[model samples]
Target: MIVTIAGAGHMARGIGNRTLAGGHTLRLYDRTRAKADELAASLGQAASGADVAAVDEGAVAGSDVVVLALPFPAGREVAAAWAGALEGKVVVDISNPVDFSTFDSLVVEPGTSAAEQIAAAAPGARVVKAFNTTFAGPLVTGEVAGRPLDVFVAGDDEAAKRTVSELVSSAGLRPLDVGPLRRARELEGFQFLHMASQERLGLNWSSGIAILP
Candidate 1:
C-alpha cells in the first residue's frame, strides 16, 4: 500500500520507516520542505518527501491510506486543507490533543476528541485513530524490552480500523481494536496522564502502555 504522511517530524519519520519496511511506498510532507527532504533522503527511494502543498494530490490520489502524523492543531489544519483531495481515502489520526502547558489534560473540548475533530473536518475521509499511545522511538525501533510494541486503534468505520490494524501489524507491532472513534477521548486522556506521569515520575520517553493478560 502507498501511504502519504503529512508531517516529517520524529513521529512521521518513524512511521514512514516502518511503512517502508512493510513494503509500502511512502510520501512524506511537512511545512518545511527541507525537513521532509532530509527525511526522504535518509529513508532512500521507497520514501519521498515534499512540502505539504507541493505534495501532488496524485501521490495520495491513489494511495491506500494517508497518515496525519502531526501535532493536534496541525493535524486538524492539514486535514481541513486536504479534505477535498482525500475523499474515499482512509485517513489515520495518530495525534493526542494534550495541553502541554498543563501536562495532564487534553486540549479538546469536553465532549469531543482530536480524532473526532479530524473526522469532522474531513467528513468524506475515513478517519481511524491509532498510534497515539506509542512514542516515536519505540515505533522506529519496533521493540520495547525485546517484545513487539502494541498499537491500539479506534474508529467509527470498522473496515478502516482493520486496515490500520493491518498496517500496524505489518510494521511489527501488535494491533488491538479499541472500539469506535468516540473512544479516542479515553486514548487521548490516557496519554495526557501518561505524559504527566513520565514527567512527574521521571520515567523517560522509553515507556509505553500495554494491556496485561
Candidate 2:
C-alpha cells in the first residue's frame, strides 16, 4: 500500500520509517518542502527502501492511505483541506489535543474528539482515530515491552478500521479496534494522562500503555 504522511515532525519520521519498514511506498509532505525532503532522506537513502522522496499536495490524491501526523488543530485543518482528495481513503488521525499549558484537560469540547471533529470536517473521508496513544520514541521500532506496539483504532466505518488494522499489522504493530468513532473520546482522554505522566515520571519518552490480554 502507498502511505502518504502529511507532516515532517517527529511523528512523521516515526510513521514514515515504519511504513517503509512495512514495505509500503511512502510520500511525505510538509508546509516546508525542505523539511519533508530532509525527513525522507533521513529515513533511508534507497529509492524504494524508505528514503523515497518528498511529495506535493497533489500527490495526496494518488495515495491509498493518508496519515495526518500533525498536531491537533493542524491535523483538522489539513484534513478539511484535503477532504476532496481523500475520498474513500483511510485517513488516520494521530493527534491528542492536550492543553499543554494546563495539562489538566484537552482542547476539544467535552464530548467530541479530534478524530470526531476531523471526521465532521471531512465527511466523505474515512477518518480513523489511531496512533494518538503511541509516542514517537516507541514508534521508531514499532514495538515496546519486547512486543509490538498496540495501536488502538476507532472509526465509524468497519471497513476503514480494517484497512488501518491491516496497515498497523503490516507495519509490525498490533491493532486493537475499540469499536465506532465515538470511542475516540475515551482514547483521547486516556492519552492525556499518558502524555502528562511522560515528563512527570521522567520516563524519557519510553512509556508504552499496553493492554495485556
Residue range 1-213, candidate 1, lDDT tens digits: 778888888898778878877767678777787777778877774444422222544567767889999999989998898899888889999998988887757889977899999999988999999989898888777778878888889998899988998888888888899899999999888887887788678888877888856
CA lDDT of each prediction against the hidden true structure: 0.83, 0.89
Worst 10 residues of 1 by lDDT: 45-54
TM-score of each: 0.92, 0.96
Of the candidates shown, which would achieve the greatest lDDT relative to the real structure? 2
**What is the lDDT, from 0 to 100, of the residue 5 in candidate 1?**
87
Model 2 — TM-score against the truth? 0.96
Q: Which pairs clash in model 2?
A: none
lDDT of 2 by residue, 1-213 (tens): 888999999999888888888888889999899999899888866335453679899988888889999999999999899889988889999999999999999999989899999998888999999999888999899989899999999998899899899989999999999999989999999989888887778877767888999
